[model samples]
Target: MDSTHEQRHPHRVVVKVGTRLVVDADGLPRRDFLNRMADEIRDLMDRGIEVLLI
Candidate 1:
């Protein structure tokens, strides 16, 4: 058996964006915050990071 044939470590990660961060305290959805979060996610994807959003 070859020792170098082991499976690579998992790099995938799951990120949960809470409602509190996506919405205001008054339970109103915020577009500005959502847009910023989207941009950040895009940046991470550009770096080959696997992100699973729930």
Candidate 2:
């Protein structure tokens, strides 16, 4: 796939990460999950998508 051709116009997005998805049973942030989520957000940003995390 040609990444350069995939560039998109900037847009806004509101992503609400659920408590359960972001925290563990002990009420601690899950590093691995957070890392993955960060990657996803980065990708979206790179695609010119403005992400608003809640």
Candidate lDDT (C-alpha), each = 0.70, 0.76
Off by over 4 Å in 2: 1-10, 19-29
For model 2 the local lDDT of residue 26 reads 62
Q: How many backbone clashes does candidate 2 have?
A: 0
**Leading candidate by lDDT:** 2
Residues 3-50, model 1: lDDT tens digits:
454335334658787765757556657887677678988887887878
TM-score of each: 0.55, 0.57
Candidate 2, residues 13-54, lDDT tens digits: the string is 888877766675566678976877789899999988889988
Candidate 1 lDDT: 0.70
Cα shift from native, residue 45, model 1 (Å): 0.3
User: How far does residue 18 in candidate 1 sit from its true spot (Å)?
Assistant: 4.0
Candidate number with greatest TM-score? 2
Off by over 4 Å in 1: 1-10, 19-29
